[model samples]
Target: MMLDADQRRTFAALADVLIPASGPMPSATAAGVPDALLDQALGYRPDLAELFAEAVARCTGKDPEAALDTLAAQQPEQFQALTLLTAGAYFLSPRTKAALAYDPPPRSALDDVDSYIDMLSTVVDRGFAIR
Candidate 1:
């Protein structure tokens, strides 16, 4: 999924509003929340692309915060969904993680343990079956 240049700028502006720069955390745009990332995360949902486009159009030439507030009031679900998607994309960026000093745990080598346990349970259940 990709956004045209104009849409990317608009989405970046929206992301800036959704996540402003703070002491440690950079704004969403600075954290590398590009429209392509957003599109990839959100494009699967039906009508979300249209809703985001409409919201961006309506927000143009307006104060981003005010526009977000109005959009949130008028379309809470869309606003929330966009917020979640934007945050998810933003936090996934290495810049954001570095800013926040967040180091995710390494992939657990024991990940297969649960599957192994489940397989054993299935085998035991089958063995104990009356038939």
Candidate 2:
């Protein structure tokens, strides 16, 4: 999509913060960009690529500090939705090591289906953590 490089970087950084490095999975920076999925996203929703540049300008105070209050206050659903979307992309990315990463083993039976759903539940609980 032709977003400015700065915007792309901001979006990536935002994704990093939203998902962070929790549990066994690596941080977004460590995981790096999911090149294939990102390319797919760029091809599909070009405008979505600008979400960070658009949100951060007004959400973060005055452009220097890293905080998210007014933005969440104003956008609410949009803010959390952006976090979920990017986090989903990142979580599905190949960088996660033991937990989130999918390893195709030669077994017909599966395990931990409930845990998978629980992990998905975290998306429903988008608690603000800029504290």
Question: Best-fitting candidate, measured by lDDT?
Answer: 1
Top candidate by TM-score? 1
Clashing pairs in 1: none
Error of 2 at 64 (Å): 8.6
Show model 1 residue runs off by greater than 4 Å. 43-47, 106-131
- Compared with the true structure, all predictions reach lDDT values of 0.75, 0.57
Q: Ten-residue segment with the worst summed lDDT in candidate 2?
A: 59-68
lDDT of 1 at 100: 79
**Structural similarity to truth (TM-score) of each candidate:** 0.67, 0.52
Report how far residue 33 has shifted in candidate 2, in Å. 3.7
Whole-model lDDT for model 2 versus the true structure? 0.57
Alpha-carbon deviation at 35 in model 1, angstroms: 4.1
lDDT: worst 10-residue window of model 1 = 43-52
- For model 2, how does the per-residue alpha-carbon lDDT over 1-131 read when each residue is reduced to its tens digit? 45455555665666666667767877765665434545554455555656644664454333322544555777765576456556655655666644564677797676989999998789669765675
TM-score of 1: 0.67
